[model samples]
Target: MPEADSSTTPAIVLDGVSKAFGANVVLDEVSLTVRQRSIMVMLGPSGTGKSVLLRCLVGLLRPDKGRVMVFGEDVASLDAGVAKDRRQLFRIRRRFGMLFQDGALFDDMTVGENVAFPMRMHTSMSAAEIRASVDDKLRRVGLPKATSKFPSELSGGMRKRVAFARAIALEPDIVLCDEPSSGLDPVMAATLDELILELHKTLGMTFVVITHDTAEARTIADTIGLLSRGKLVTYGPTDEVLRSNHPALRQFFARSTEGPIQVL
Candidate 1:
């Protein structure tokens, strides 16, 4: 990938991307673009390969075909030499921060340590700097005094907030959230959505959220990409996609059981 104007190029792009596990095709020729500094929500039913797409975007899983590009680099292109390949992968991953579903926090580490984990692993910042960063990030997430609490001590919403703090610890250009609002009550989910929007505006970083919740998608998505049965069924602005006449999309948004999307 040659150097291009950032203003014109997308922050992330997938071209003819496909992935499969033996006979099960998780993703098939799925192409999409995520604009810079915007929130792109990927909505789909369960087992529709939404998580697979996220993995491809971050280079965790290589697609069977096509290209995954982030910040103008083809992630699928790896050097033949092992060391070089590892370095390339690191560089690509360093540009992203991921908040996995269920928070994925270490059971043994305190909230502060969990947030500091990335900085410790990735940066040469001194102990004082790391502590300051942890405090700042925790405070930013509205958990100023949660440094000493263990993951087990926090509520589900608080755990998610801690994970959000950790994700932004490195201050990466893009944040990938895997079902940020999952496993929360309606009020808590809406609270998480507000935090996501607030952080996006304040930090000016791009976000890609994966979720099955249509209301959450409408809340946060500047663009919505609907996936079904290994294909991108619809991709456009939120309102446009909601208004689509596509059978599968209609079934999905309406939560109807009488359409092309069979509940099986």
Candidate 2:
């Protein structure tokens, strides 16, 4: 992978971004940039706001201060009125597709219906066109023949793959994945990782993945941002961030209890 040109606008930028829920500050003065066509993995312990940050990037959560720029538009600056904000967010969200943890499929829908859901909702494509696209995407994710299966019938990994197919059905420029490897055995996790890599390379889309798995991050991240206690402990190229001496990050990646990161 080549370094992104500094002169080019980044795919996503978060500057001095902060978020809170009631009195709890989930993110404080966090800043990071995701390069175009690159994979950025955000690593952190649970409840450290990794998912919150992802939500902010996609305009699901508005920050208290600072700005979030996606594809050069400031999402945080949208109008405060509910209708206007929603309109703006809808436009911004068109550029992104999200894969939630646990797949989040509709239990009543078949795999084919789930994969075709986005296109059905977002596009006016004919039924034939949507079916063709769903088949293509399912095949891409290695689930060609499983479309008739319901969510309940598939394994955890298969459900995840179906969710992934749904996410990319619209061909969004960016894909946000929350814990893509969670709840899987090592072999299944590895399979999912390879699929992520393959899709990234073949589709050339930017990916922002929130994960607690350091090894998965190391495998998929071109850049790594480690969050702790509502703050970004480190952010840089994967190798550079991994080489840092930051206490919180050191404890995180090394899985050690002898550092500043104490589990509650």
Please, what are the lDDT tens digits per residue for candidate 1 over residues 80-166? 357888798788899899998768999899999999999999999999999999999898777999999999999988899899899
Residue 86, candidate 2: alpha-carbon lDDT: 77
TM-score on alpha carbons, each prediction: 0.93, 0.92
Deviation (Å) of 166 in candidate 1:
0.9
Q: CA shift at 183, candidate 2, in angstroms?
A: 1.2
Q: What is the C-alpha lDDT of each candidate?
A: 0.87, 0.87
- Specify the poorest-scoring 10-residue window by lDDT in model 1: 1-10
Hey, what RMSD does candidate 2 come out at?
A: 3.3
lDDT of 1 at 211: 88
TM-score, structure 2 vs. true? 0.92
- Residues 87-127 of candidate 2 have per-residue lDDT tens digits of 87788898899998768999999999999998999899999
